[model samples]
Target: MQLRHFQNEFPYLVKALLSAKKAGRLSHSFLIHNDDGKLADDFSISLAQALACTNPLPDGDSCGNCVVCKQLEHRTYSELFTLAPVSKSRQIVIGVDDTIPDTMRWFRSLFHMKSSMAGGIKIGIIYDADCMNDESQNCFLKTLEEPPPSSHVLLVTANPFTLLPTIRSRCQSILLLRNKTSYEDEKIRGIAGIMWELMSSSNKISTAEECAFAMISISDNLEKFAEEKADVKWDRIFEDSKYLEPPAKKRLEKQHEAAISAEYLKMRDSMLSLIHSWSAQAYMLSCGIPRDSIANPELFPRDLNVISSIDPEKAYRMMRKSEDLLQILNWNVDTDLAFREFCMGVEFGK
Candidate 1:
């Protein structure tokens, strides 16, 4: 997609980037973050095109029809080097002493090569950069600190906090609009249903206990879901590596475990965000806000009678509790215990 397509949604950001580029002040390195990975990916490509487009519009956006723009969109440009997690473990590793594709070493070698286009600049994009292991990140850090001339590196991630502070401090940070949690997953929708039941229940103690147990059960199911998805991915990798040495296979198993953990955490974070959004919306309803104005209006209690029964002060307190629950979950606290505490502490109804 071209930069102009995003102008309506990200006017300020698009304008600022184009203005900077026009003035020859664009940053050499950028850290672009967004909860929606696909959006970040598209935006990064658009930004790259804007910087390298041979034909730019009067508004300073890229002419999407240009050869350079088409090459960038297709990721076939000789000067564009891209790296992402391609392993079953979903990690970008510091490769073997010899360069291997998708590894940090290989990416560095390609990026540092003489520009394939005369007097052209190179663009290196590391999608899902947070998946880079510590060693890989450190190896990439050298490129960031002393980058090749006439080059730009874009580090794209949904979780920037996982990157080292040194790496973060070196790049210009661009955070895109975070899309709301998707309820398309049946498991997520089921969890939201349980939360709504807990909020609408009149018997606080009994409902809390029941909801806590249900939440824990669903949480366990989410882990299983992640494992099942990871297994499908690992099966292909395992089949290809059947001839590998035992030690190498063992390392692959460990990486598979990490991939499962990463998958589970992604789902769990979405679940938690939904919980927080529901509580905040409930508080808004209590304060006489229109249901249509709040986030995820369809996710709110549909019964008008139930909506009118919420106590403003109680709902506000519950919203605060949800925020605290989200914060505490980031620590090393026990997941089951945290859910139980959060469910028990929530207040609902008149």
Candidate 2:
């Protein structure tokens, strides 16, 4: 409904803004940090409304009845600039380009326009801020250094380490801690969570978490499955190799199949890497480190019981084997054999 959605943990962030409004201490820039996709996105949108709310509730959130709140909800507010990178297709995509989109145009025309709501703040939300190209970052740096009054720039990132130090130094970072409960690399744990919720329980999931888990499982096993058959390679040159080449005469068709296989294998290896990363993240998290810090704290909050029973070191060894399986399979090995080996060694095959 409003920023209240995050009232539990980071109630202080809102409280800080509200306090600032009372004491007038709002900063020009905020670097909102989190590894979680769900929270960071919501925080950015809520911050936008909170800064621009023309009416207020007693609890310090925007009054839904206000004109500014309506504009934000409908996404028609001119003051809000949500910039991300454009893909090669020039279509807007996340983490691809550096330019805060429309920053230049806003400066050009912004001076002539009146605030949509009286005495409202202009809000700029930049997701995937690390994707800024050199040119785009430079352009953004100009605006960031000379921020317009009554405007707040909230830059959201999962990987702030990859961003320029100059940019990092300029903004005030508000690290959002997530995974305070169970910790694993979010993506990989998500895969495991899907599996646990599905296979570990009889209840059904409407979102197909089971399907996602199976896809990830297959991907994780693919490389090891191929690697175990390192003794074999298929050559389509000889008469006996005709079947290996798939008798279709079209060269493009053959290439297409090869591309599909390549892509599939790459994805599979990614799952393996993700598993290793996730376990490591859990381990780290289990040790009481802030999940807010690392971009890839694969051991953030480990299953300490698993870590104690299996040990983090052993888990890491398992991760390496997963990686090895993925690598060896890429060289053209027997898929089923490699797969079986990995399944046998799931979490080091214990």
Candidate 3:
């Protein structure tokens, strides 16, 4: 429950804060850029605890004996605010719509309240800053322009370039050093985390089926999104893949050590492509265009028109199943050929 989550989990802000604390320098606004997986997410939350804790060590550790410390361990702390991109569960791309005036109002209203206990700092953390659209970023910019005296904003993202240039310039940014931090490496470890959990289920076949379906849904949307918005860059996903250094790269290469095969990696690649496809499909469907109108094999088109032509709810269910399967696949699975069975399970009528 403490900041020392794991030996490898180096909650990042330790070094950053140490440098700033020693230099007697701290920023009112911060944008933390790094690779995905829960590493950055976990680190961001821990940093919030460390910052808000009234009882903290000079070495930047929280006093585990305090009420605030107990609150953080159980995720019931009032002073902490967390926002992240919409998952497949929401079926909404995290865009301007998600960050409306009402949304900001909701968060601001919460922050306006006094701390539940004495001497705790209020903290705001966004899990994916890059997911915010231009307008939404503009909306947030106003919030950052006038942060509270006892408040700090920490934004986590794999791709900061997608953020508004103005927004990037305003915040103090923390870049995860390659060798220095595993907080940014979300490769094999991430996939492993997902797969191990899935393999533990009572029905491995159904679990695998769900993963296959979810990947297709994700791929369809990503592909469609790419096609519709050429200006859009999935630079983050690829950057996430590329950010792997010698150690991470070695881990990926040593998939066999983890009981993952080459086929598993291929399926993972296919899963990425499928998400790209789903992006394109999502854009088209949202825009009221026929899925078949833009049928380019190189492009990702869910043919949502065709799929929904039969049963819209059924098709949507498939997407949900796909998401479920992906979650299960996150655990220990043979990356090489495991997805073939998964993809086949999710294949539906044309």
Per-candidate TM equals 0.54, 0.47, 0.45
* Superposition TM-score, candidate 2 onto the true structure: 0.47
Superposed model 1: Cα runs more than 4 Å off: 180-350
Writing each residue's lDDT as its tens digit, candidate 2 over 1-350 gives: 47777767765556666666556566778888687877888777776777778787665676765777888877787788676655664322323333334443343245224567566688877787766655556667766787766788888887554556567667866667675434332343455443223222222343334344464465565544444322133232233445654455456456545655674555554555554455444444444445554445343334544333334444444444444555555557875566445434443234
Candidates by TM-score, descending order: 1, 2, 3
Specify the poorest-scoring 10-residue window by lDDT in model 3. 179-188
Best prediction by TM-score:
1
- What lDDT tens digits, residue by residue, belong to model 3 across residues 1-350? 44555334433345556557446576767887676546676666666666667677666656665777777666687787766656644221323433443354445555556667566677887766777665557777777887765888898887555666577668876644232221112331233323323322334566656655443444335434333333233334335668677787676545423333333454455544343234333333444445444322223224554333333433333343344444445556554343545444334311
Q: What are the per-residue Cα lDDT tens digits for candidate 1 across 89-124?
A: 999999995368899999998898887788676899
Model 3 global lDDT (CA atoms, 0 to 1): 0.53
Of candidates 3 and 1, the better by lDDT:
1
Number of clashing residue pairs, candidate 1: 0
lDDT of 2: 0.57
Candidates' RMSD to native: 12.2, 13.4, 21.2
